[model samples]
Every structure is written in C-alpha cells, then in structure tokens.
Target: MDLRQLQYLVAVAEEGSVRRAARRLYMAQPPLSQALLRLERDLGVELFTRTSRGVILTDAGRELVGRARDILHQVEDARSAVQATAPDDSATLRIGAVAGPLSAGELTRPILEAFRALHPDVTVRLRDTSFADQVDLVASGVIDVALVRCPVVHDDVDVIPIAAEPRALFVRSTHELASEQTLSVDDVIEYPMLGLDAPEWFSSFWQLDPERGHSLVDTQLPPVSTVQGIQLALAAAPLVVTGCATMARFAPSPLIRAIELPDASPSIIGVAYRRGDTRPVVRSFLEAAASAAAENIALLPNATSSV
Candidate 1:
C-alpha cells in the first residue's frame, strides 16, 4: 500500500478508533475507515478486531504495525536528512546513548572515545536518553547512531549486541536486601518498584512479568527516567530499581547496592544504527564496536554528554 494508506493504518492502530485516528490525522472518519478497509482488502488479511471497548490489532495487524512504523520512520529520516543537510554542512555525527550500563561501562565507553580519536575532524554530538527507546531516535535520524540497552525492537534499526549481562536490582545500602549479592525476582518485586520507561517486551527487564504486570506496585512509583533519577529515588524512598551492569558502576556509594539477578533475562547491551546505513563514520563506529566486544577490552572513560 502507499505511504498515505500506511500512515492511516498506523494511526488507527495507535488510536484504536477510526474517529480518534481521523482526529489525529486531521481527516474525516469515513475516509479513514474506508482507507482501513481498503488496506485490509489489499493485504488479504484482517488487521483489527472491533469490540465494544475499542479496536484491537489482529496478529497480522500487530506485525504490520511494526513494519509500518519502520517504513514511516525511515521515510521521515530521509526527508529530514536531505532537508536539514546542505552540501557544505559541517561533518557532524549526533549520537545518543541512554543513561546506564549502556553508556557507563566497558564496551561503549572505549568505543565512544575511540570513535572520536579515529575521526578527530568530525564533530560528535552526544545525548543521554532513556534505554532501548533510542532506537526510535536513530531510525528518525534525530541521531546518527546510539549505544543503548537492548531488545532494540524496531525493525528499521540494526543492533550490534556487544554484551549479554544479567539484570540487577538496585537498592539503598541500608535496605535489608542490600547485603545479599543476589535476589530472586519474586523477592525483589515485593518492595515498591521504581519503573523505567521501556517497550512492552522490556517489562521483564524491570523485574516485572507480563502476567504479573506491575502487580508489585505498593504505590505507583514515579517514572525514573535516568540513572541520576534512580539515584535520587533511592535517597527518597525504599524502591527497588532494576538495571544491568551499568547499575553496578552507579553503586559505589554507600547509599546504593547492586544485587545480581542470575535468573533474570540477560540484558543485551549494543550499538544501534539506522538499518542499511553505511556512512563511513557509522561503519567505523560499528567496526570499533565489534573489535571491542571481540577483544573484550575495556577502558573506563565515561561517555561524554551533550544536550
């Protein structure tokens, strides 16, 4: 289907109602509904199941929705890059690395400084964003590349997984569980949980089960968006925060402890770039990353952060 049709499909899927999607797209409801029907007919599959509550994506719709987001994000990036870049534009690479293990430790730290040393002439712009969600930043060309916590999830971006480290539970050192080097998910979940914003598949990374779905919440915890925020949170409340190896680095203070989760899903730390991107800088960054992971060499210079 054409981009217009794909856009309409995504809108309906996201908003869950034709009328709402129409409002979002600034279009009439009838045409949006007609467009949805046309798309389903052309694809030869039912995309959504209508119910009293709203619309739910069928299995096929769920699949197509991800594909649609990828296509649209790529198109938007292409348009932005072309329009924003002039022939004489300065050589700059915008990179986003989330705040945590992805940016703090062995793999990404060396690679960041290494990439800069290798391409000294290029201006590198760095931003610290929330975990995993940086895939959207890369696909949209808001940044040229990213180092982020895993399950990149978006098909339009490519991830080079550097390390598979177990998730950890962070708590105040004074907390009872702090002395334990490791803890079970059930034990960790019993405390008030501080959650990070991540994809649905990432709920487990937060020590939350899909079926359990934040059942451990004593009070709905405020959103902790960064490592600094999590640190601030520890001083304020007895909340259990879950993260990967980077969390360990943040735990040197007497205020916090990093407890291992051997049974938790192995947190995938990686570099992400737009799918099919082959610019020399991007390639160099990837090459550096592969070498870092292969050699397992680490130099602990922290990532440089910019707005």
Candidate 2:
C-alpha cells in the first residue's frame, strides 16, 4: 500500500524468508512479520507460502515483486533528479575495476581518457576490484560505476558493452592441457577449476553453460575466494578457467599459460552502473564509454540479466 510495505515485500521476496530479510534490513523479526501480514491483508492476496525451509512467493507475489523493484527505482530516480537541480561543480566519480584488465589497461584506459576529455572538470578516482564484487559495489553505492567482464549477472545494474576481450583457458605450464594450442569448452569442463567465490551466474559465465560452474565447495581444487585461496591457487593451480585472459599480469608463480579457446565467445568488457541511475554525470560517463568503445573495441551489444 505504501513504499515501506513495498520495500518490505521486495526484501521478503528476494530473501525467501522473513527472518533472513529482517536480518538484512537490520530490523527485528516481529515487526517485519506484522508488516507482511498487513501487506497481504491490504492486497487481499496471499503473497507467500510458508514452508519448513523458507517462504516461497505465490503467483501474486511473483508478479508484484518485479513491479515493486521498478517503482523503487523510479522513486530513487526522482529523488536523485530533484537533488541534482544544481549540479556540484566538483563532483568525483569513483570507478571500480577488475584487477586484471584494469592493470593491463585493456578495458578501462580508453574509456577513462574519453570520459576525462568530455568532463574535464570532474575528478575521477579508481579502485581495484574483482568481477565478483563489482556489481555489489555499484548496487550498494560503494562506487559510482564499475568496469567488468560480461556474461555477468546484473539484475539491479545497467551494463553497457564497451569492448570485447578474447577468452582463453589458463593452465599451469606443466599441466597437460598447456600443450594444446586450442581447446573447447568440452575439453576443459572435465577438469577441476579455480572456483571463484562469486555469484553463480558470474562463476559460471566462463564455461558458457547455465548449469556448470567451479562452485563445488568440497573439491580439492583451490579457490579464488580469498587471499589464502589465491595463495593456494598459486602453489598448486588448477585449470584457471576462461574469460580472464590477462590474469597472469596480477598472478605469480607455478607458471601459467593461456591456451586459446578458439570456439568460446569473447567476453564483452563493459561499464556497469546501478540501474535507473540517470544522473547527468553518470550519463556523461556512459556516453563517453560508448563513444570510446565505438572507436576502439567496436563490440556489438548483447544485453543480459540473471533474473
């Protein structure tokens, strides 16, 4: 009935449990439960069906949840637009980027230069982040935008394709696959891979398979989830997987070589900003990125989302 109730509805729908949603919202369980009850009563519809594991959205709930997100995004846009009636002359855009391509200056440099050329007065700041954390950073407002690899999931962000980066399978030089000049997805999926402790969509993007990813937690394969996991990966690297053809620039030891995945589609490197964020500076940055991309990588646009 109100924005508060809609927010409560979305939180519960997304989390699939009242208790989990309450914890995420930093609120107590009782009030949240009452709010859900009140919302259901007002709508005269059962939004959720409770079960032993958690709450599941009913048909009505499923229909309303998407509209609720759109409404929230529009409300945010109105608020941002009102607040920006008088633009701040000294605005700083904080950009987050994955370490590999960013370090190699393959994905971000031209866009950054183009942005600077267009918005000479604005200040730009950079932070090194991984594709794993890029979306969360933008969604949580930790940064203004992110340079990330595509085949990524962005249910709550807008990703604009800027360039294409080739895909390669990374293996330790001594690994058996290293001798192969070209490989296919079928060739690599059988082996252990460095499980990126990332969203399922992101972790699975490299494989080009909706059902497969390096997320088997019990496997002996080292992960890229933490600093210790990274260390373990360096010591005994597994099949390092695809999409990050420039990873060797940041990683050391055990020696790695990238074998061409001649059949795999190249990943589209893009700039992702929170969806419905239509601020002028954000627009400027996007336009700059598009222009730079057109002149540089000239990649075709293919939009996607996990949800």
Candidate 3:
C-alpha cells in the first residue's frame, strides 16, 4: 500500500522472522507485526504463515515479495534521481565497479581519464563493489553507470560490450599447475575451484561455463564475496581462481601465477546502466569506455595451443 509497508514486507521476507526483521529495521516487534497485519488486511491475502521457527511465505506472499522488491528498488531510484539533480550536486557522476579485473588500471583508469577529459566540470566518484552488487547498483540508480563483467543477464539494465579478454587460471606459484605455460578448462576444473558468493549470472560468466560445458568443480572453501577473498583463498591452498588476463597483469601477489586457459572462452567486459537512462554524462562515459576498449584490444591475452 505504501513504501514503508513494502519495506516491512521485504525485510520480513528476507529475515524470515518478525522479531529478526524488527531488529534489522530498528523497530519494536509489535509495531512491525501490526504493520504486516494491516498490509494483509488491505490486500485481502495472507502474506505469511507463522511457525515456531519463523514465518514462511505463502504462495501469494512469494509472488508479492518479488513485486515488492521491484517497487522498493524503483522508489529508491526515484529518490536518488531527485537527489542527483539537487542544485548543489548536479555535476557529480557516480560509477560502480566490481572488484578486481575490471577495476584495475588497465581497464578502469583509461576510461576515467577519457571521461574526465571530455567532462572536466563533473566530479567522478567510484564505488568498489562485489560482482553481484554492480547490476543492482546501476538498476537502483545508486550509481550512474557500472563497469561489469559479462553474462550480465538482467532486463532492467542495458549493457554495451566493451572488450573480450582471454581467461586464465590463478593459483599459488608453488602449485603444480603454476609452472605450466598453458592449461585447458578441464585441467583447471580438476582442482578445487574457489567460488564467489555472487549472483548466478555474474558468477557463471567468470567460471568459463561456455567453454567447459557449464560444469564447475566442487570446493570445500567457503564462497568469497570480493576479489580480495579470492586472492586470500589462493594463498591458503592449491585452489583455482578463474579471471581475465588483466588481473594477472595487475596482481600484487608474488606467490600467485596466472596460467593461460587456452581452451576457455575469453571473458567479456561491458558498461551497464539502467535501461532508460539517457543522461548526457552516462552517455559520454560509455562512449569513452568503448573507445578505450577499442584502443586496447591488441593488449588482450591471446589464445594458444594447450601444453
């Protein structure tokens, strides 16, 4: 019925308990429960069924929760749009990037330099985020644009393909595969791969699924949420972390070795923004990014016969 009610519904659905949701929302349990009851009464449907453990969403609740999330996202976007146009802050451009490969100097720095060259008056702000969060940030207008790795299959955002670079397997220099000049997707999959705690679409792209029959090996290591997590995991074991060649070029870890995955398809990088965004700054940055990608295409990793 209202944004606050929708927020309460979403919080309850995510937290799975009225008491827990109340704690998360910084509100008392009674008021939160009362709000949920009022919402259900207005809608004439039972949103959740209470249990001793926690609340479970009824079939209608499951459907409504999805719609509620979308509505909340739009509401947030509207608020951000208005704030961006406030008299004092109209000249700022917000950019979001997934940690590691795309955020490195090789890709991000050049794009920033080009955009700034064209728009000297705008102040650019960068937000480093997980791969899973990049798309959401763009869609919710939290950032004007995002530099994201591909297989970004969301209808709410439009993606412009920038560059396609070869994929590599990163492992500790002391690992057996580290000495090899080239490896196959199959070879890399034999090791316990370090998985990322990212959206399925985002994570699947980095896994070389297209080249490897969409199969990834199991891992005992807990899933990592950021690039640093992947690096830390590699330092601790003989695990495999798949990424673009640019990552190998910029890595600070002397113990890490990036071996060419000749058989795997190259990873693609793209610029993503909300579908209907026509802001001049966003368009200018995207154009600059595309130009930078074109100029650096020759620098991308080349495929070779597996050794």
> In model 3, which residue pairs have backbone atoms overlapping below 3 Å?
none
2 against 3, candidate with superior lDDT: 3
- Using lDDT as the measure, the top candidate is 3
Task: Give the alpha carbon lDDT tens digit for every residue of 1-307 in model 1.
Answer: 9876887788888898876875444334555677788999999999999888879999999999999999988886886476445454337888888773455366665676777788899898888777546667898878888877765545466677665666788888888888998787767656777766555434344645432443454345566666777777786777776777566764465678888877665566677887667567777887776666655533432222210
Rank by lDDT (best first): 3, 1, 2
Residue 291 displacement (Å), model 1: 1.7
Give RMSD (Å) of candidate 3 vs. truth. 11.4
RMSD of each: 9.7, 9.0, 11.4
Q: How accurate locally is residue 298 in candidate 3, as Cα lDDT from 0 to 100?
A: 53
Error at 172, model 1, angstroms? 2.0
Q: Once model 3 is optimally superposed onto the true structure by TM-score, how far is the C-alpha of residue 291 displaced, in angstroms?
A: 1.8
Residue 133, model 1: lDDT of 62
Candidate 2 residue runs with Cα over 4 Å from true position: 1-90, 103-107, 207-218, 225-235, 248-254, 298-307
Show the lowest summed lDDT stretch of 10 residues, model 1: 298-307
- How well does candidate 2 score on lDDT at residue 276? 67
Candidate 1: where is the Cα deviation over 4 Å?
1-90, 100-104, 198-204, 211-215, 297-307
lDDT of each: 0.69, 0.67, 0.74
Give per-candidate clash totals: 1, 0, 0
